[model samples]
Target chain A: METQLQLLNTQGFKHTIRRLCYELIENHNTFENSIIIGLQPRGVYLSSRIVKELKEITGLSNLVNGKLDTTFYRDDFRRRSNPLIPNQTEIDFIIEDKKVILIDDVLYTGRTIRAGLDAMQAFGRPKKVELLVLIDRRYSRHLPIQPDYVGRVVDTITSDSIKVKWDEIDGQDEVLMFTDNVEKI
Target chain B: MSALSVRHLLGIKEIQASDIDLIFSTANTFKEVINRPIKKTPSLRDTTIANLFFENSTRTKLSFELAEKRLSADVINFAASSSSVSKGETLTDTVNNILAMKVDMVVMRHPYAGAAKFLSRQVKATIINAGDGAHEHPTQALLDAFSIHEKLGSIKGCNIAIIGDILHSRVALSNIFCLQKLGANVMVCGPPTLLPKYINELGVRVETNLKKALEWCDVANMLRIQLERQDIKYFPSLREYIMLYGLNMPMLESLKKEILIMHPGPINRGVEITSEVADSHQSIILNQVENGVAVRMAVMYLLAGAKQ
Candidate 1:
């Protein structure tokens, strides 16, 4: 059996997004020299929402945004039982010599972020790179990667899981934490 | 959420329709990857691929090599004419020797049909059949179908006609299987002698008249005449075959509808199609060649991931 707990509801999710957007605007004033790249699969939802919130706040209609898929850059190729399926990478704009803000839904293991760093080199060498995440699972860092902008920091064990659900994908905007419990007879 | 249904890409016939869909979708990503300035990925950095050609090839070999390199896979090439094949060493012996060096995958083209299948049973490495006699050329078929799918937006219910030598063409065989699996209505057009005897069993419509086939289909994939494979004359001569079956500008313009033109290369300039038609706006021959690399890359990537 498993137990589910709702960490952030719809109202709280909206507030967190607004705060993250403000923090981004505080760092990147005009964002003329900066770009937002959404990591593909689940991260795309968080990135797109962040981009929308940032655009609404700054009124920058021409904000450069792209989606990147890092399946190919993962170090675990041929190491897993199931094959890794890749998603579409729609980065039409160049990231050359610009500050790239990579957005994802959750931060865990940090391997995906590492792969994203490697995948970004294909587009061009960015002047600077930063990572933003909606949920930061503390004590789960496998690689030496820390989010530049984190929405919420939650301490978790190795076996625990964190899932950030968005209205665009999961039909609801909330953060859920699940813990598996095995009962003895 | 999906992996290839089969471990090895032996032929289009051996895979399910979902496999083709997966390959096409993966190729779409690789297409973007190849267009980038870097044009390379470190997906297969630790994997090693051995390209063994028991038959002579130019484009398929080069395309596989390029795909392997682009994916960061260390590649080794073997030409039968220059290797132990000339020294009367058996196929199993040669491939086994290569496997002893920790070769992970084998991309092979052989003059005999079922060579790849045979090697797969004899060894443990992944086998990708480049082409085997007149049996199948899976990757070529994949790229051809991908090009059509890209241009037309969808492949289902599309009227696709394959023109020219069907009897000796592995491209034709593989294309028939691939297109049919994708839900496309396929028709083979060629001289009676050139069409395979058991082609009707494949459930494809046989059209002897070239003009009628062109008029009936939304896309026409013109196959090259394999003179080297044919020991006996299937038709009277190249000139007569061209006059009857050749795809010229006049023939294309007379169709009353815009149909995509394609060829699995090494084109017989005036024999299968005219130069004007080959270079026409409707021709996607070069696109087929370009997609070849991406499609191969996708296949290698998926197969590599499926490896145990």
Candidate 2:
């Protein structure tokens, strides 16, 4: 058996997201030259939501956004038991010299962000790049990555896992924390 | 996290439908990767692949090499003609000698069928059968199916016709198995002599008339006649073969409906398919070649992570 906790409910989740959007606008100003790039799989959900919220706030319809998958760029390719399946990276517009914001649902070990930075080099050299996450697992980073805009911060041990559920995908918007069985971990 | 069911990609017949789906889905991601400006991934940075061609090849060898390089895998090329195989070194000994260099995978093309399978049994490295005799060219079939699926949205319920040299072409055998597994109706069109004796046993329709096959299929994959592999005369003359089995622009224009044209390539030019037809907008031969790298990359990527 495992212990579980509900960190944020639907109302709190909505308020948190709106707060993050306002923080983004504060930093990005008009976001005219800035683009939002969501990491693949889970990240796309949060990033898409953020993109929509940003558009609603700024009234800018042409804010560029794309999804990037880091499976090929991941450092742990063959380290795990099962093979890593890659998702589609669908960035149609040019990212050269543009300020890019990378978004994910949860920032855990920070390795994904490192991989995303490497993967972004393939598109073109961005003028600047920043990281944003709905939940940041503080002190659990394996790499030197810090999020520019964070919704919530929770200090976690190695065995603790965090999951962000969205209404669009998981039937509800909530943040859950699970303390896994030590042996299983 | 999904991996390939088999350690080696020996043949299309050896893999399941789910494996094909896995390869195609993985290839979808790789296709996008290759189209990028950088066009290189570091997934296989620590791995080394050995390209062992015991038979003559131009496209398959180069394509495998390019795929390996694009994946950032250290690659070494070996031809049987230049290697110690000509000096009577056994298959086991030659591969073992290369495996001694710590090669993680082997992409092989040999004159005998099941050579890749035999190598997998004899060695400890992942094996990819580029082409083994007239048996299976798994990657070629995969890329052909992928190109068709790309153009038509889905391969299921699509009419795909494999034409020419069915008996001596590995591409035809693999294509038949792959297309059938993907729910595509397959019809093999070739001369009576060129068609295999047990082709009907595989459950694919056999047609001797090219026009009938073309009219029936949504896509026609034109195969090259293997003149080099013909120990005895399969057809009387090239001119006669062209009249009966060749794909020409005039023949294509005669069809009431437009059909997609494809070739495994190293084309015989006017012999199997004319330059006009090969270079036409309907022909996806070049796209097939481009998809070959991505499909091969996907195969290598998946197999590289397979449980040992």
Candidate 3:
């Protein structure tokens, strides 16, 4: 059986989110030209929390927030057995000449971020694109992608998995890392 | 959850109910994407697809090519008339040559039944059956069901009547399979000779009277009479068939309820359905055509994504 290693509990997760929110406000002080896009599935949960915190701090009610699904753009689609389940992408406004902040829960292989870059092209060309994540698995990069804003960075090997659990979706806020020797079955 | 169980989409018979639901859900996203200002995505940029059409098709050919381009896959078009298949090249050899060029998938429309299925076995590339003679056209049926689900809110329990040319139509066969699988009540309406043998065994009601069929169905899918596929006239005459089976304004109004009209085009305007009904507000033929691209995109995306 695999033993769970808790990297961040409820308090730590909340503190990290608040810190990320403040850092976002420091760089993106105004909401006129900036849009926040969360990568679909888990990324949307974390991004929404940050967006909620930003709204509470800055009193900006109209900060453009959308979800981007990268299922169709993944490189490892052919290697998987299950048919890809696609999530909804709801971007009501245009992204032309706008700053795009892409938010996700964890950054490991950097393949999801690359796919996000490709999916973003379907909307409009952004003036600038930036990546944000709660957990950055250090030294495990498959693509040359680095996050602009990171909450925590941890060193991990290829056989490890980092899982982020949210309170809204997962019934609790916690980050866990699992070693691959213990089978998930 | 995966969208499909099978690697290649050869027919509706090979697909499960959940697979159709997944395809529809994926197509819903593509539908939104196609309506945007920047419609193209770089999702399949690294993949390559080939359109190998052994039979003549204007809409399916163009629709598949457009879907491929929208997904950003490298696309090549090959028709039998211009290819080495005309010079006595075998189907396997022709497809193998295309596969040799690093083609990852093929959307084929052939004149023989089970052609796409046969090609799927001979080659490793994913195969999407555009149309294979009188066998199946899975994507067309998907788009048809999708259009219905879009208009009617859901396909389950909806009364759908497929009218005309059941014997020689792959669309009719595929649609019957798809609709039944999705919990829709299906009825096949055509002339006695035009109706297929053992169609009742497929668990669909068969009706020869056009008026009764129209009165019973919530949606009427009028199929075009396939002049190309007909070796001999199945019915007595075109005029007689139109008088008995043709859908027009007066007949539609006689139904007393707003029944949705659909057709897998190119429509024989005055034959299976009149221009008035085809152009009416109830007609979702154009929406069916629009959904074609989205459905094809979903199928190609799923197949390519499941390549391993």
List fnat per candidate, in order: 0.75, 0.72, 0.65
Report clash pairs, candidate 3: A83-B2, A83-B3
lDDT of 3 by residue, B221-240 (tens): 99999989899879888999
- Per-residue lDDT for A38-144 in model 3, tens only? 99998999889989999998999999999999887777776776656678898988898999999999999999999999888878899999999999998989999
Worst 10 residues of 1 chain B by lDDT: B1-10
Give the TM-scores of the predictions, in the order they appear.
0.98, 0.97, 0.92
Candidates ranked by TM-score: 1, 2, 3
lDDT of 1 by residue, A1-185 (tens): 56777778999999998999999999999999999999998888888888888888889898899999999999888888877999999899878999999999899999999999999998888999999999998878998999999999887777677888878768999999887632310
> How would you encode candidate 2's per-residue C-alpha lDDT over A100-180 as one tens digit per residue?
999998998999999999999998889999999999999998888999999999878887888899898789999998985
Docking class of 2: medium
**Stretches of candidate 1 exceeding 4 Å from the true structure:** A180-185
Comparing candidate 1 with candidate 2, which one achieves the higher lDDT?
Answer: 1
Candidate 3: list runs displaced more than 4 Å.
A81-83, A179-185
For residues B226-256, what per-residue lDDT tens digits would candidate 1 score against the true structure?
A: 8889999888888899899989998899888
lDDT minimum window of 10 residues, candidate 2 chain A: A176-185
Better of 1 and 2 by DockQ: 1
CA lDDT for candidate 1: 0.92
Best by lDDT: 1
**Minimal lDDT window, size 10, model 3 chain A:** A176-185
